[model samples]
Target: MNLLLAAGVLAVSLLGGARQTEAADCPFDEWRTYKNTELRRTADRKAYFWITSRTAIDADGAPKAYHPDDVGKPCGATGAGLDCPSNAGYPNKSWWPTVLASDPTNPSKAFVQPSGPAKGFFVSKTALQDSANGNERDTARYVDASTIPYLVFPRPFFQLVGTGKPGDLGMAFHLETQKQTAFIVADIGPDEPLGESSIALFKALGGNNPNPRNGSGVASGKVLYLVFPRSVDQRPRKWPMTQEGIEQGAETLLDAIGGMSVLQACATLD
Candidate 1:
């Protein structure tokens, strides 16, 4: 498949947990650069990047300035918002701030995607804070369905605070529309090791997904599994398998995630 088409599909998949933009926004085609100029006050401020495969035209027939934050509550574009539904069901509490960066190329307009989702932003707390609106502008407004076929990386690569390394352990929340329940993947392997303490933490929060092998699970290092509802149906068969297997799977999955160089590979960001 073409690169643009692949991105469009990925964007739609991610929106499954959220909402999709309208039909006019389908077949995403171009990428527009948006600058969170407000983030300039802080030394940490960096440009947020967005890739769009579709475009949207406003009532005026002028291209609309897009910001992905309009989708749901402020979930840290990182992995935090994946489970945002639990926060309040509608307005996600973890959403970050976002805005339509002024397009340097087109002085009269803001940065925009030419083809896919009409708008998307690289999310960063610094950028939102830098803006006078903070996280409210995007989070406050209802998501316009016209924007789809896009990906919202709350935090773009260059914006990560540290080395931009993936979390030692990655945590994600997925909701099966049919089941209407949340499935969380609390990755504890590679850079992030999980042990009895982490398992206990899961139990404490009333959430499941504990390391199956016990303390030895982290000895060699591995990805442990835990599922909500704690039902065998929702769990990964490999989970609770053996310490050695946990280690193997963790390594395998990490390799797929930019080889541990980008962010800790997450089993399910979809």
Candidate 2:
């Protein structure tokens, strides 16, 4: 390789390693960077990362910007309703599919696919909020973005966090706004382009006018997200996971990792 190219590669490698070493001061654990995103884990079972904030709407009635279908804008994009796009296509086809049919009637928001593997009912492509809101391929119910605070990571990250399903892990957030909230692992997205959270999580972090339908989430990298894996309760939880429960559950785990103040210090590692 050319001398300049080799030098550039070396600089990136050294910078990444140095950052990891600085972030993972704990001997028992280590840190790793991906696509310039910095994340760390402790032997005591805590995983934390500093990333940007982007809004995701994976639940029923999760529209403020673009209405994927008629769930939120049941009456059509006029009265408290978001108008359907002339072309019905969502950014990622998992949570909201490219093809959708909505009921003309209100409150009976049934989304149908003209034809597909999930033809009978509108299937959610995400991992969390199963049975309806997520992967179960049913009508959207529970896990409302207007209420629940959620975070999305890749499936591999979930495996790396180790031993937890959706809503099982406790998450904590510290935004540049200095706003913070307890969140849950509620969805899974692509492996790259990290930093995606629910609409409530966006609002929780003081994000203004959060939007998800256009695949537009906050792009500024001034947010921090930390998760405690294996912090799940012995029993699985039902849907409609409450923010109160998430906060209560996250408290002890955050304390275990030296509390939110320490996490704040971590935000400066890069």
Candidate achieving the largest TM-score: 2
Q: How many Å off is the CA of 80 in candidate 1?
A: 24
Question: Model 2, 1-270: lDDT tens per residue?
Answer: 222233234334433444443544442244666556666666654455545543443333243223334443333314222223322333323433422334444323434444643343342333454443442323344355556677767666666535355766555344334456778776666565566667777776666545554433443335556666655553365455567777777766666666644543454454
Weakest ten-residue segment in model 1 by summed lDDT? 53-62
Worst 10 residues of 2 by lDDT: 79-88
What residue pairs are clashing in model 2?
77-82, 77-83, 94-125
* TM-score, model 2 to reference: 0.62
Report the lDDT tens digits of candidate 1 across residue range 223-270: 212111112232234122232343344344334333322211121221
Over 4 Å off, model 2: 1-28, 53-126, 130-140, 159-164, 214-221
lDDT of each: 0.24, 0.50
Q: Tell me the deviation in Å of residue 175 in model 1.
A: 13
